[model samples]
Target: MDIQLLTRKIPIGISQCALGEPVRYNGGHKHSKVCTQLLGRCFDYVPLCPEVAIGLGVPRQPIRLVKSSPAADAEVRVIGVEDKNLDVTEPLMEYADSVVPALEQVRGYIFMQNSPSCGLRGVRRYLPNDHGIDSEGVGIFAQRLREHFPHLPMEEVGRLNNSEIRENFLTRVFAYDAWFRYVEDGQDAPRAGRVIEFYSAYKYLLLAHHQQKTRELGQLVSNARALEPREFAHQVRGGIMEILAHPASRKDRTNALMHVQGHLKDYLDKEETAELTRLIEEYRLGLKPVSAVLTLLRHYLPRSPHQFIHSQLLLAAEPAEMGFCDFH
Candidate 1:
């Protein structure tokens, strides 16, 4: 059976300010066009500002994470930049706990960068003497959310500027949604057979991401009969997500594309085979985009009668409009 990816609007969490809301401490917003224009087309954002949620008024004093001592494992506090005595660390973390239930429906999240309350990483921390240390803090609210949903596809809006990171994040988000749609959300008890079927769609995609880990995951799937259905599903989902956590390197992607190309060669004429092989080689050498090769491969996909190739998610995982082809 061909696995269908979610095409409906995916509900995801985002910082209110990133959505152009003036929810910042200074009554300004760091609006992102990528979030508003690009991702907004596919995602329904549930926006929130933890500071605002905790009753901190808009235009309130800015807060920063502060290390009480210079020690490596010092206690960090979210304190007012102007008035160090004003602390809201607990409130920020508390808001994350309270809001998680509402956010349970969201499959992914995009955080605002450099926020003491929401940055996923690399937020600045301050020393007692007012010295600042860069890239030393995780936002209090983001930290709590990580603890609550370790597998969620979370990223800072700033990092989405990179093509590979943006594509990888969206890939994970789609796969996460696909899991619920195909396996997790089924009315029947989760079946090992169903989970394996789901895994089939992702096989090539996983190979593109990490060949070694993908092989290990295959081993796990081979033993799915030994484990309970729910446990098997959980293990596979975790494995799939973990493998896709990093952007696939060009070398690995070329390898995967070549493997895919092998399946079609048997059905193509000599000229067709040479053309396809040339494009794949060009893509491997970075002389042409992967899309070029993928387009030709897809054009020939109908000639062959392999059900597995027809079911491969790597071919149809991304929507054309997302401009994922332009990324590489």
Candidate 2:
């Protein structure tokens, strides 16, 4: 199936500021062309601003994560840096809790970086003395979002500047959407069978991400018959997310590419095999993108097609969604 034809717009969540909204504390927007011009073409962004949604108006005082107590389980509070007594942590958390239920339809989210309210990671936390900041804090709102939807693909827009990270995020977004659609479409199928089929379709894609985890997931799927329906689906989704969390190394990707090459080996002559091998080596060496070899492989797909190879999302999850080939 042409996955791009499956939908024109995939629902996604985004920080309002990242979408060029003037929702920042300083009444500014950290507009991302990647999100706005590139990804925006395919994503239906549900823009959110936790600070604003919590009744903190534009041009409000900046909030910082401050360690409030020295106790073992000390709570961090989002308080005004200028006026330490002005705490807004409770309100922000409450707002996140209230808004998350409405975001269930979103397949993925892009957070603004270094924001105390929206940064996905490395947001600075201030010590009570105000002498220094620790980089261990995650944005309060991002934390709650993760807790609510652990399997959803969420990344900070800053990190998407890296080609591999960008590619991985796009892959996960499309895969998550595809998985959701698969479950929705197969509502009447035996649960175990649906789980198996879903995993099967994503097998090669999983292999490209992580081989050991993919094998572990396959084992987990085999045991699905013994587990409850919801439990089985949860396990499968968790395993897939864990596998995709690690960026695919060149070695691992080469292994997967070679696996695909094996599928077309019988059809290619010696010269063709050498040329394909050279292209794969070039990709492994970073001289060429994986799309180059995949494009060649796809050109030959019609000559000798296999159901498994053709169904692999690794080949093309949503080529036209956002010009993903350019990311490679």
Number of the top-ranking candidate, with lDDT as the measure: 1
- CA lDDT for candidate 1: 0.86
What is the C-alpha local distance difference test score of each model?
A: 0.86, 0.81
C-alpha positional error of residue 187 in candidate 1 after TM-score superposition, expressed in Å: 3.8
TM-score of each prediction: 0.92, 0.90
What digit string (tens of lDDT, one per residue) describes model 1 on residues 125-219? 99878899657799999999999988889999999987778888899988888788778784877888778988887888899899999999999
Task: Say which candidate scores most in TM-score.
Answer: 1
Q: Per-residue lDDT for 270-312 in model 2, tens only?
A: 9999999999999999999777988888887776667877766
Q: What local lDDT does model 1 show for residue 253?
A: 82
lDDT of 1 at 302: 96
- Backbone clash pairs for candidate 2 read none
TM-score of 1: 0.92
